[model samples]
Target: MNKTICALAAATLATGAAASEPIAVTAPGPQGDLAGTLIEPAEGKPVVLIVPGSGPTDRDGNNPMGVNASSYRLLAEALSQRGIGSLRIDKRGMFESRAAIPDPNDVTISAYAEDVSAWISVVRARTEVDCVFVLGHSEGGLVALEAGQKSDDLCGILLVASVGRPLGDTLREQLQSNPANAVVLDEAFAAIAKLEAGEGVDTQDMHRGLMPLFNPAVQGFLIDMFARIPAELAAGVEVPMLIVAGGKDIQTPVTDAEALAEGQPAAKLIVIDDMNHVLKPVEGDSRLANIATYSDASLPVHPELVDAIASFLEDSKS
Candidate 1:
């Protein structure tokens, strides 16, 4: 692993009695530098490299796409309080990593997986550890599985709020889940079918509401994503895995987690009943209520989430 330290800055994590100063870290990327934030607890402690989910989410888990919850940042702080270290990163060509590539839309799952391999090398060198655990949230989990297939250096794989089915199927389910989408369901389904068949959809005539999801700029990436079945990837991963799902999550439900665990029978699966897609605890079944948490930065990630991950990592060591 090459030591590519461009600059350093301090970030204080104020979580109860435990706190650690996060340092800015960078790894060499194709065009420029891939940026990340590392929170190290102590020497010899286990470290996790957190991969962000879909779209333009930053290292802190906030994105311009109506997501301001800071779930990843809060999760890192919670883990640090439990004596665990973490490094959360922005995806290549997005956020602080915008310089890594010319266009964020021009990417594939495999490219993201390669970036994970790069981050793992950086994490191992910085922490002086033999291997690092990978905690991938949402679509990032698929990247983890893809990386696991190619590398034997991972301590374990952690899938949080990730879909176990092929991305096309999951997209169909998500579109159908909302009653308001009934008017455009047929069009959405047809588009997904085309993408799954390795064909591009003409979004020029797509519904205004669905244009953002099926934008022409991202169709290439979506086509690549549609071809991947996460369950199949999970089956090929030759390492310990922890699959955590949120029961109240409308995006990727608990069944998706179960499918992953089913694919990898030896993997551990935990379902948190009240947790939403963003890792925040929501009380009811109202769709509006659940989506509200997506923009709320004050809410901390579910307490059980941190505990589940910490416990799984400790148990995996034995």
Candidate 2:
């Protein structure tokens, strides 16, 4: 909901000389094959699985629904430069994994966690690695934590711009932040309340601008997502966890990161001063300029974002 719906410019793929061929990897899903791209640098290097955020995001972190940051592509190249390999994936029913399911909306957080577990096995077997680190961005962070709880092969988690509160509260905050949304605020809240209560909202009376978020097709998934409390989930995470927050991020604020830290206490929290939700550095505070980066794939990811991950991974290697 942070991004406007529009056509996105295609994100340019990054090339790395040290990186191996774009190894196509797949896992058995209930529907079909869950697809991913594994960029193995060499043996012994830790493989970081890049779990993308919500919507129709592809393996490269761009979504045809107006998001073309290429953040995950740049992240993979940066990790490769740091002697770490990466496995970026297209979620089941999304992008290249579209064949995995007939209806992309027919999925839940648990299913994504299962997909992550499957990807981990694929990475370990293909790269001959002992364990893999998962770097989840936004909603993907919740999936990583859920997957980490179910698997012991995880090295740790690097959560970026992710939620740390119940999704209902987060959604309410997101709706209230925009002055333009004032017109439909009451309707949005009512719909969210119903969804949070495990009941489906009848979007027949919904505002045109809010219909997409409360539509019948995605209500089941959204209801499942709303019930998930990120802080509660993070509290049970037994592996090393790093909570990253972008100071300029308009979606999930730094307070959410603080909540995760408070819940886990053991998690390392890093707040990058100028980095936004897209993992890019923005100079101004204007919402328009901040959101402009979503479709601008040319901008490089902030160097500090890479530095943070590199430092964390290096330090955690004991």
C-alpha lDDT score of every prediction, in listed order: 0.87, 0.84
Best lDDT goes to which candidate?
1
Per-residue lDDT over 1-318 for candidate 2, one digit per residue giving the tens place of the 0 to 100 score = 012122222122454235454567787777788888777755456889999898888888898788889999888877776567889999998777888898999999999998888888888887787769998999999898888776577889889999999888998999898899998998899899999999998877678899888889999999999888888888888888889999999998999999989989999999998999999899979989999998888898888988888788877787
Which ranges in model 2 have alpha carbons more than 4 Å from their true place? 1-17
As a whole number from 0 to 100, the lDDT of residue 254 in candidate 1 is: 92
Q: Candidate 1's residue-wise lDDT over 21-113, tens digit each?
A: 787888888798899898875544688899999888888888887999999999998888766788999898987788889998989999998
Query: In model 2, what lDDT does residue 81 have?
Result: 66
TM per prediction = 0.92, 0.92
What RMSD does each model have against the real structure? 3.5, 6.4
